[model samples]
Each structure stands twice: as C-alpha cells, then as structure tokens.
Target: MKLEALAVYEQPLKWFALGLGVCSTVCVVQGWQLAAMLFSLPFCLIWMYSGWLRTEPQLKYINMLFSVLYVYGIGRYFWLQA
Candidate 1:
C-alpha cells in the first residue's frame, strides 16, 4: 500500500493515541526504555491499526493479548535491569 493510503485517526483512536503517547513519553523519560518502546510502537500501532481497519472482534481480542504480553515484557525488563 502507498504511504498516503494509510488509515488515519477517528475520534476514539485519536484520543487513545494522545493518551498513549504521553504515557509512553513518561516511561521513556523514567528509564523504562522497554516499556516505552513497546507502548510507543507496537502496542499503539496494533491498537490503532486494528481499530481503524475495523478488524473482527476476535482478532481484536488477540491484539489485546499481544498488548498484555507487551506489558509483561516491559515489567520483566524492569525487574531484570532495574
């Protein structure tokens, strides 16, 4: 797909992006690099993309599981490194 063909934000996702962006920035600043990276990138991207694409509810549930895993990985990193 072309760069311009990407789905941009609607109301719900626009708000979600704003909140997640701020939280991710805080995590990055506090030395939670893994959390920040996961929250800022893959989690946010997956959430937004799936929402925008109107993916099936079951797939959205799977994405939610991935998000939970992302958070767990961040927690593990903090425990190991911090």
Candidate 2:
C-alpha cells in the first residue's frame, strides 16, 4: 500500500481531527470526560464531512452513530453528575 494513494485528502481538517483525537485520549485518561468529548467534537465533525464528501453511506452512518454516542456520553457523565 503506497502512502501516496492514501494521501488523497488534502485538507487541514484531517490534521485537526488527529490533534483533537490525541488530546481527547489524554483527557479521557485524566478523568475529564467533558473535556474529552469536547475535544472529540472536531474529530467527529471532520469524519461527518469527509464521509459525505466520499459518498460513503456506511461511513456516514457509522460516524452519525458515533456522534450520537459521544453526545450521549457527555450528557450522561457531565450533565447528569449534578
């Protein structure tokens, strides 16, 4: 597998998602669920955009499910803690 073939996406959003994913992992391990979800927002958003751009129904639906689950987790852990 050549990296050149897989490097078709020439956008800053992918990099943004990567950075956020790393930070989100750190936040999760630190017990900062709210922050983790917040960080993951950009990553999920990018996937949603690319998923549609790629015309991939499966990718789009999976990303949609992940987005919903992420939001639900945030609400359940952060909002309901009160």
Best TM-score among the predictions, by candidate number: 2
| lDDT tens digits, residue span 22-81, model 2 | 999999899887899888866887787777777778877887888888888878886678
TM-score of each: 0.43, 0.75
Query: Given candidate 2, what's the lDDT at residue 4?
Result: 39
Scanning candidate 1 in windows of ten residues, the lowest lDDT window is 2-11
Span of ten consecutive residues with least summed lDDT in model 2:
1-10
Give the clashing residue pairs of candidate 1, or none: none
Per-structure clash totals for the candidates: 0, 0
Which pairs of residues have clashing backbones in candidate 2? none
What is the C-alpha local distance difference test score of each model?
A: 0.67, 0.79
Regions more than 4 Å wrong, model 2: 1-10
Candidate 1 Cα RMSD after full superposition onto the native fold (Å): 8.9
State the lDDT at 12 in candidate 1: 62
